[model samples]
Target: MLTISAWKRFLIWVVIATGLIFALPNGFYTRVERHNDALAEIEQLGATPARQEAVAAWPNWMPATLVNLGLDLRGGAHLLAEVNVTEVYADRLDGMWPEVRDALRDARDQVGTIRRIESDPDVLALRISQPENMARALEIVRALAQPVVTLTGAGARDIVVAGENDVITVRLTEQEQAATDDRTMKQSVEIIRRRVDEVGTREPTIQRQGADRILIQVPGIGSAGELKELIGTTAQLTFHPVVGRTADAAQRPGARQVIYPSIDEPGVFYIMEQTPVVTGEELVDAQPSFDQNGRPAVSFRFNPSGARKFGDYTAENIGSPFAIVLDEEVISAPVIQSHIPGGSGIITGQFGVEESTNLAVLLRAGALPAGMTFLEERTIGPELGQDSINAGRIASIVAFSGVLVFMALSYGLFGIFANIALILNVGLLFGLLSMIGATLTLPGIAGIVLTIGMAVDANVLVFERIREELKTARGPARAIELGYEKALSAIVDANITTFIISVILFTLGSGPVRGFSITLGLGIMTSVFTAIFVTRLFVVMWFERRRPKTIEV
Candidate 1:
């Protein structure tokens, strides 16, 4: 009953030793983190003496991963923003105007001449020259409708077209609006995450809250305002053909053009076509660099189609000015000196080095689908997080010491075996956490303490079962075998039930609740393995080595 194969013994020790090796790095977490960060920087920006020194501080062969601290344990910013999904509805209508015009012009003989009329931004109104052909006009516009492809809006039209007298009104169908909202939220989350990651934060949480909201929490950030500035920029970069320069702000060139003030020159405005020759959507990469005049600038490259369009426009419009607009402000309107065949160009303005880098980051991350209004903001201080870490440390020490003493006093030598297993179990837990890069928070520390108390329950049950068998006149070895055999069911049932509870908590909870669930769940698995397997191995080794004819459990 106490026998163990050499292979199994080797495998068990291998796992324990591997876990200890991985957990060792956490003892020097600050140094390891610095080393890792230095390595990443070197990879990104090339090697420097300081970075090389930092990388050399920690060996590459050693485990470099550390447990990521959660927002509660690290100073950071938190924000809850509501994405304005309704804004996309107006944009959708504006984009459909060209298509609608083309469709009506194709059927002009049947519907007569069509003229766009003023209405709400979310609604398209067109006046038909022929009033009697209203039904025919409706039929022609309705043919442009497409089915909404979503679970909630399946089989529903994307647009609804209606006509009364000589006027026709167009609006997005309810189902299409719902689908658009979902897509907008998803795009917003991704863009926000990309923007946050570009700054090289350790771990940022960018997630959707509901139908039209997003929750962002980034550890190690200074304040909510800083985070808002990082992801809040619409960064709608567009290159438009400059019609002319004018001092009059009231001058209206055409319905399809607008005027914007110059960034460098005050009191001067440039009237440019509303339709952009190229937009940031086609940009594949952007980086901060210096212009010919040694000033800070952002260099960008466009995709194939964007490059082709840009080349054609530049070749045809040489010696003409085109304005580079960002957030409705013209950065600079420069004349095309030559035909640039490649998709690459430089954007220059009165920008500092930091501004140039930030612009590059934004261009690389792409633009937000729609604007967001922050509903809540918070900035957690590092002092509070330090206090929390200190408190958690003291609590863990107290709980661990108490558990060790109680076990030793209760079961003597056998209890010492359980204590040793318990120590290794904690090591294994940290090992797994580091390997997975799990985030640890205050509640996660509590989960570890709870695990310490529960880890010995199976041992206690087994020891009690052995004592009962001894009273029945069984031999020590036989009593031990029967003890482990009979206690297996109870141990499995109890741990399985607790594991299920952990799963349910993880599923329903967020933030700190989730951190606690991760540790609790991981601790359960490690404790069961150490208690049943490692402790049993120790007990069997003691029994076989001593060959005790009569002994205590």
Candidate 2:
């Protein structure tokens, strides 16, 4: 039997646990009282009741309740995207391989080519079959290729004649080269984050997985379907010459104006072109809504230099046309209506919500940092998440009940007492979760349920220790003390090992797995507290009431 001191220790432990678990998210009776004085003051100035209602409905005054829901429970879009370095390299080969082309051209010019010349940005392959001319060809090609990538497909005339026509593909070392790996994946993650934020997703969690992937979680998303539409669009932008829109417009026989190609209208059109000498990069900000005349329009502000340049350009070409060319298509080429020298202008078009959103996404992410391609995407519905939550709750109830019944039957009154500790252990777990403001995903709830079974393991250790000691002829008080002392090492070592694994998991695991580890870690500490104090106190009190004690654990 535990002494009076033992009972006091148990009660203090319980009280401490309750305070941490229960009294935290808000104080015991603390309410979030909203101050309405500002609203009342605003109402005093309101011109009409309708206007006051609009002011009251603004999100700034309301504290939004944003709960993080599990991927399965809350329903969301899951996407997997891979960086295609092959395509990037291919593009480099197509547009920027001037050195390779020049090498082939110079090789041809020097060697007097009778065959074909095919050169990509990264590789130059040709069929200079004349044996006498091959030596000069290799020398010219060797002089031009970047170091570590030179004259690969080379050999004797016999080797060439047998099967090899001059065809060589150059590749760089993995670390020294650009490819779809962790670094590229991380870049893609940042770009995607920028894109999602451009669409106004607050508090999005975007992260990279390995060398070639990203995981994104967007909470309280309203534009999920729009996200699906945009997943694979590689809308990277760069500044190119406006190609003399003013000249084109002045040359135009009619008043049709030029514009650029974008999601708003992705096709070229013939207009009186008045191309701005400056490109879109000069734009500092874009606001979308109805124009002064109530038509959908985008208002753009320019940098200081851009403003001055705009003023100068418009001043010079007062009667000229300026075209807004995007992706090589003109959306609108309104005649430079009296020169927008202020550097700010409006893009008025037949735009709806979808087109406006796409335009906003473009202006916000700032012409994509690089091109992207989607390699994976999955849409999750809320129904699936609801089903999973329902199943988890049922399983928890069944698992918890089984634990209570087994502990009670096996240990009699002592088992029943441990059962109460078990109940308190679970209550404290949720209370802690609620207090910490931690999200309870389905996996997290299951982790708590599993913790219940493990919680009893510590008490079972103590109970069996006492039974063993009493059987060995110790007095009740001595047996109880020895039992607790002997059980301490085993209990701690076991829980500590489990807790270590949980820590490792929380550090290394992703998403839901981390949730499991977090709850498991919390469980270990709480289980030890409940087992050491409450169970021992119950045994001590029971001995005082019954007075006879001898049993097999």
Candidate 3:
């Protein structure tokens, strides 16, 4: 009566074989990793002879997916950075100056001549020549205010306008500021993630810590300094119409004008409009290429909206110099010879090939919404990671060996069958991990060790029930059948509860805790299958062949 159907037995062995095959790559981690990296490079940059040889290191027909190592196991760079969200307020005010000027000019007869005055970075102050027209100026500026677009900021205006005497000031409201801070934080996290992904590092964690702080952990990077260099550059590129060139650093520009020194020329500065014709935010693509003179450069293309604005600006400003600014410095001021219809352009400066390539990468990833100041930085060395791995390896082996010895001593032939199933259970766990591309941390290793011990509980339960069942007059087959049937409910109940806890941990926790939960959840599924199906199948096969009238579990 205790028997597995032919199809069921076939299905069980097939699953076991597939799992072991998928898990085989981890046995040769170094070679398989090189093969994977080489394949990625070939897909991205085309193949070289060396890359082809590396790809051949692993056969194409075999499974190549690997379980990623977490930062704790692989060593990496960690950084805590605080974003300068307030900086966007100044930029917002600067951009609003043109609209404010246009609105007030429409009422020039009432407000008289308007001029910008020196004020705080967060405020836009305007002075009118007519003292009695202050109310009129305030009304015009207040009319330009729009409702904030965020859900919590409903019914709140984005800008607040106030006036005293002949001066009117405009600044963002409190609700608007809060909304802007939220947007800034989200954008910063995404941009940082994009930059890290561009470098192809494994399993980097980029998450917001608090209101204006971010936490970054990148595995397999050389140092925190290297990671900072990769993501730190603002790479804020803009094009503005040049007002004039000057060498006097102390010279003040009129309203709506800014001065920036040339990057290549010493002591030379260019005064330019504060408003840009187009910004890097509108860029859709950028690539490293050679300019007309065969010098290294970065070629960029804009989205549709940006293309129209760029084309119109170039068409109207022929023969005028346009300054290309990067991070408040003028990279070049080239004269527009004719109307350029296309949205594509090249940035030429003092750049090497590597510089151009890196620039292209940054441009494609988009500029950070605001600047960041690093608060804490640390680099974990690989030697520490190797020691951790060695310790985990020893722990897993000890746990596995101890479990095998105990099971063999207690239950004779049935114990041996349980031991075999336990080994397969571990193999199946690793296979599932590889298939899902889960990251393995030190805590994850501990979870696997715990799983090895827990794997035998179901077998022990079934074997004990069989021992009691043998006391009756019923034969070995009936006792075995009843033992498995009776123990099924307890096995499912216990494992299901633990699996739910693992799911909760994964949902609520982060970093190493998540790694542990993933391994534990997977181990539960694999262990249950081996204990119930695999061990039972082994016993049934032996009984069918030998047909022993008397048996001992």
Q: Give per-residue CA lDDT, model 2, range 1-553, as digits (tens).
A: 3575855876757666664545233222112111222344455444456545544543353332222355665666666655564554444333323454466566565555433344443442446544456666656544543332223323211111111344433333333243323334555676677777665443455777665566766643533455645544544322222334232323443321233443344434344333235655567877676778887777777789878877787777666555565555555665555756678877667777567657756665554334545566666676777798788879889988999899878877778888988777766666666556555567777788879879999988988888889888977778878999999999999999999999999899878888788789888877887798777777777777877656445
Which whole-number lDDT from 0 to 100 does residue 490 have in model 2? 99
lDDT of 1 by residue, 1-553 (tens): 6687889888989989888888888889888888998999988889999999989989999988888887888889999999999989987887688788999899898889988887887898989898898898888889999999898887899999988889999999999999999999998999999999988897787788878999999999999999999999998788999998998878777766789999988888999877688888899999999999999999999999889989999999999999999988999899999998888999999999999999999989998879999999999998888998999989988989999999899989999999999999999999999988899999999999899889999999999998998889988999988888899999999999999999999999887788899999999999888988899899999999998988775
- Predicted structure 2, TM vs. truth: 0.62
Error of 2 at 108 (Å): 24
Which candidate would rank higher by TM-score, 1 or 2?
1
Error of 2 at 85 (Å): 3.5
Q: Candidates sorted by TM-score, descending order?
A: 3, 1, 2
Error at 439, model 3, angstroms: 1.0
Looking at candidate 1, what is the lDDT of residue 377? 96
lDDT (0-100) at residue 438 of candidate 2? 59
Worst 10 residues of 3 by lDDT: 131-140
| Clash total of candidate 2 | 22
